[model samples]
Target chain A: MKFAFLILLTASMALAVDKIKLVSTTTDLAWAAQQVAGVHAEVRSLLNGTENPHFVDTVPEFIRLVGEAHIVCLVGMELEIGWMPKVLSRSGNAQVQPGGKGYCEVGSAVTPLEKPTGAIDRSMGDIHPAGNPHFWLSPKALAQASTAIRDALVRVDPQHLADYTKNQQALAKSLEDLHQKNMARLAPALAKLKGPAVIEYHKEFTYFFDAYGIKSFGSIEEKPGIPPSAGRIAEIAVAAQSAGVKLTLAGEYAPSKTLERFSELSGIKAERLATSIQPKGKNKGYIEFQNSLVETVLAALSLN
Target chain B: MLKNRSLLILFSLVCFSQAARPEAAGTGLQISVAGDIVGNFLGTADNRLLPREGEVVLYAPIDQTWDGALNLAAHNEDGEYKFEIHELTIGSSRLIPRSRFKVGQYFLGVGRLNQTHRHDWPFTSAPKVQTQFLYEEGVNDTGAEYSYLWPTPFYLDLTLGITNGWTFGHTHDEGKGPVLPTHYLRLVTYNDLFLDGGLQTGLNYLGRKDSSGNNTSLFGLDLTAKWREAQTLTFLFQSELWYRIYSPAAGDVENTIGFYAYPQYGFSPSWSLGVRVDGYSVLNSKDAGGNNVGSFDYGLVPTFSYKASEFSTIRASYGVKGRLSQGAVSNTEHFLELQAVFILGSHPAHDF
Candidate 1:
């Protein structure tokens, strides 16, 4: 009983620590937030790593978490397009609103892919209309997101600025060192590849391809987010055959049917690629996700 | 003048509250209240047979998991009736599985021969046979059912269960209990075909036991080929064969056999048109009611249904019973129905 009292006192003191309560929209942000906040903050990600971030429900439990968060971070290049606006208004937390200091967007500080060049329409199946928000699939993209979060944390609580800086510097150095090693190992294979364009099931690999001086010929999705039309698949089959594009990287969550149809039509083998680290077996986290990308690109080169 | 001033004050209060608490304005709480604001402008003379006709359905789902749900509704037939607690236990794991069980008047697993709600005859008429043996297999029940959804490319859902069999929307006196044995088994399947087409198949079984240990059974099967994005050709064949043995009610019990089949087509996204010809017999109830009611009977039911979206549907169906039609009493008045559907607290949102 006496020991229990001492434990309770310690626990209360720990809970009373100067806390920055954070709610991350996705696992990557949760991971990035931890890099800066360390033990000085409490962090939680609203979405499961396996679920499509765009389709997260406005569950009551989710609302309660958002209500208590001192800060909220999201990959803002329209990744959370359908969810953020509604959740923000419903959160009743002015500190985490769009223009507030607590609202930190990961992508505004980093570049986005396939930004809409014109006005939007709804024929597209749930495209963000702003830009592809899947930029965190690359190491550089992950580092860029951390930098943005660091800047935002600096604004929110200047008292913890030094601590945040030290954390960011340590994280950045380790990330750069790992990225260099992987690049060195992968440089030879990337140079040997003579493919005209890479093919993918979804529009998730543009940043990964761009980092390695590669170009994606087209997406198997006849339209963005829309399942491939029969005629479109037939057309792509012919183009792929002629263009000698042998690499088809299937997104971790893409339908197997689409990949099968593409493979059967094009006579090219397809490779499965992880979009996020999840479900235990697949590579997870920002770093592991980036490293696993080399296999698909290499597979296409090997086929050639 | 007094009313106008009150209205002005109310409207101002609304605006002032919204502005003052903008952050909390759009925050909708988990518990919400919604119902169909129904308007029945067009009515037939037959509808006048009822003193009143309007229903307000109220539902509260346990959560997004759909692990449990309770629904209540007031259908003012005589005055109004309550929709007692309807429970459904949904499972994500394979060992135990998903199920929809209720201890109130509810729908049975048979209508799932066609899972789309709009496909039911006249949109809301859930087969007369279902009502004969059981007042409703479509609303609430005083029984429990266990369902298994097999993890396969072919989406096959299997269900089996036992219930209290009484259908007054709730369980009543023990003496009133028929000790009616209720057992139900059903299966439905779907498979991807070609570039566009798909296949659907279904089967069902139901057995009832009396207090004296007498038992009756019903069985069925259905299949369909969906070729286009919104079109399907379906074929159905069902037989209700019963073993008329072991009843102490000393009345000359007889074995019965019934069969049914049909082919139908869906013409548009919102409209499905079909025709069904079916027949059934009883182990005992002969032509006692009227009109050459042979143990074997059949009917050609041509149906037209429209599902507006995932949430609402309308249907109209008509049929002519032949001479051999079982339960043949008189030419019945058909129906055209409009129904609104809403998945409460938790519904699985399909992701691409």
Candidate 2:
């Protein structure tokens, strides 16, 4: 009789568990979430700043994290396309998968860009048919991300509603200030340059580059993700030479020669832009990345 | 060449990685690698191509979610002639109608290395007969598999694969437009070690070939035992025997048996030593001839594996082999090999 009573007490305590501990795929997302939830939730991103956000995997640790979490927030629209299915299925975390109340897609309501128009298939290279899934890079998109995520948190912790609102407001205010500062810093270039241009692989920077008045004329690939051909390179070189464009964008995975050839032909400078920031040693937070992307693009554009 | 190869691999990784589905799987990406080096082929100049090497698949679960996954994987070595999607299976569990089905490109039913992942591999080499009969690595097909597991971890994995029986040449089917043999069935059970053999956990596999007319069969029995904590010893015995009545490549009815036995002791987590003896031959085949060969080998493989951190590992091994079966040895050869595998991102618990 005493053991039975003890078991009932333990089960009650388990049922009352409230804190929703989470592990994100990228450090930037984790840090941003931390800024909002702080002590209300324990958050960790699986990859350091160097890993690719689009391809992070949820192995045992990730599986365990999801199992322990009350709600899972993900960058949806096929961003984490390949691995998310495997991890969620193995994790047995119904709340975190699509269609579940606990499943939180940060950008579900945000309007997207670069969405695939034709029939989707692998022959077309890495295509995100849901449009540019890197919505976090744009401040407006971030605003939308906050709304969707806050709703998710509210569902997870109704009693802690006040706490969630406070953290979210603080994060939103900080973002507003940063957005204003970035716009001001970028105005000089936005006004002075006839047109700032770049060559990109994936259309990842559409929001950031567009917001800052930077123009990307063409991508390295003739089609999305396909390697640039000799003919395409020659054409881009001639066009860049004519437009006085001086900067070329390079993802960490791009071939060195492609960047070099662009420089040799069009006299443009290539800069390595980190598209994803994982949470780890080198990249402590997303703020560092924001300043870096702006400064790098500015410096590259200024050179031309 | 390696640098160039890495760039190409990275390119394909980025390109093919674009495959994404509805967000639901999980958060975080992971990659893992496991391979081997022949004992006699170590400590020599011709070590570029060792026992075998393969791609370490990359997956991001958190961002993509279930139903959605970003798989970027390719062989790191060379693309002279290789398949694009080798380890392309995805983990998925869903209710279709009233039944549950798992869909992915899995090597199920009856191939060594098909169901056994490298990280979970217990032996250094696969069965000799299968390796001898097949030239390509991972003779797997692109297929959708449905597996049903009773409350027991025991499982009945069924697969329906579509492709040319042989994975060779540019034309997979040479205008055959896929083939007649479209599906293979596999049944396996893990109840206990021989119903109750304190010695080990037992698993057996029975796979029906793609066609009903021709049958290719394989049976595997494995055991691993730790005799005493004092010595900390382990013994592994595996035999993969095949009886295939039809194979376009062999052009004959055949029966083949291959076996590998390895016994080792762990001095510590970072160090260990072991001896392996392996051999295979075509016991019965219509085309059996001088080409149908078998060999017996005795070798010593010393390994040093260190976990740099929770996310990474560095393992090095040195092995020496001697030909115990006179002419069975392909050639009196001495070789040296080195491998460096580092995985960063989300990963399963370290079983190395």
Q: Each model's fnat?
A: 0.00, 0.04
Task: Write the residue-wise lDDT of candidate 1 on B1-352 in tens digits.
Answer: 6456546644643554454342653432122122332222222323322212122222223233222333333233333433322333332111222223333333555533222222222333434343443333242345666655454433556777667654332233342344565667877665545743445566776666565545555555555544433112222222222222324444545455444454556554356776666555554555666434355445566766665533334545565554444445544334343444333221222111
Cα deviation at A95, candidate 2, in Å, is 2.2
For model 2, residues B149-266, the per-residue Cα lDDT tens digits are 3233232223233333433211235333333434454433322234211232334444334433444544554434333221122222333433434344335666655555556555
Instruction: Give the alpha-carbon lDDT of every model.
Output: 0.56, 0.54
Task: Say what the RMSD of model 2 is.
Answer: 15.2
lDDT of 2 by residue, A1-304 (tens): 9999999999966754645676566565676677666666777665555545553433333544555566677777877755665555545555666666667777686788777785765556567767878777776677667777677778876777788788888887887777778878877776666754666655667777765667777676666545577888888787877887767776665556777887788888877667666444433556666777777776865731
Model 1's TM-score against the true structure: 0.50
TM-score of each: 0.50, 0.53
| Candidate No. with top TM-score | 2
| Model 1 chain B: ten consecutive residues of lowest lDDT | B343-352
